[model samples]
Target: MRAEAQAYADKINAALALLRRFIDWDKALRRLDELNARVEDPTLWDKPREAQE
Candidate 1:
């Protein structure tokens, strides 16, 4: 590939990587929200999962 074309591709990749950072942050926040919703419900511990004791 030509140098100019390669340079453009590199720039696009860098921008995409930066954009994915925001996407990752959005997903993390969503997961935290779901976790917080379940955690604050207070009935999640009543299901009786495997006990470590």
Candidate 2:
């Protein structure tokens, strides 16, 4: 019984870790989208360094 409980706990912990990674990935995608939108602006070249980023 104790082993079963430990197994369940391990699975839950693994799932939580995966969820955190997914959230970070989603945030990164959103940031990329924002940067891409900025690149579409004609004046983006005004700050070439920022645009290149």
Candidate 3:
């Protein structure tokens, strides 16, 4: 029984670790804001290469 419990805990910990790696909400939000700001800029289209990027 204890071994089963330990295995369950290990699975939970592994899932938590994967979640931590996959989700960076703050950084994602900041990057989204930056893209929004860039899109709002009129000068964004002046550089064709940069605009394509």
Candidates' TM-scores? 0.46, 0.44, 0.53
lDDT scores in order: 0.78, 0.89, 0.91
Better of 1 and 3 by TM-score: 3
Q: Alpha-carbon error at 39 in model 2, in Å?
A: 0.7
Flag the better candidate by TM-score, 1 or 2.
1
| Better-scoring candidate (lDDT), 1 or 3 | 3
Q: Can you write out model 2's per-residue Cα lDDT over 1-53, one digit (the tens) per residue?
A: 99999999999999988888768877878999998899789999998897777
Off by more than 4 A, model 2: 1-23, 49-53
Residues 6-47 of candidate 1: C-alpha lDDT, one tens digit per residue: 999999999988988778877878988987777787667777
lDDT over C-alpha atoms for residue 51 of model 1: 20
Best-to-worst ranking by TM-score: 3, 1, 2
Score residue 46 of candidate 1 by CA lDDT.
75
Clash totals in order: 0, 0, 0
Alpha carbon lDDT of residue 28, candidate 1? Answer: 77
The pairs that clash in candidate 2 are: none
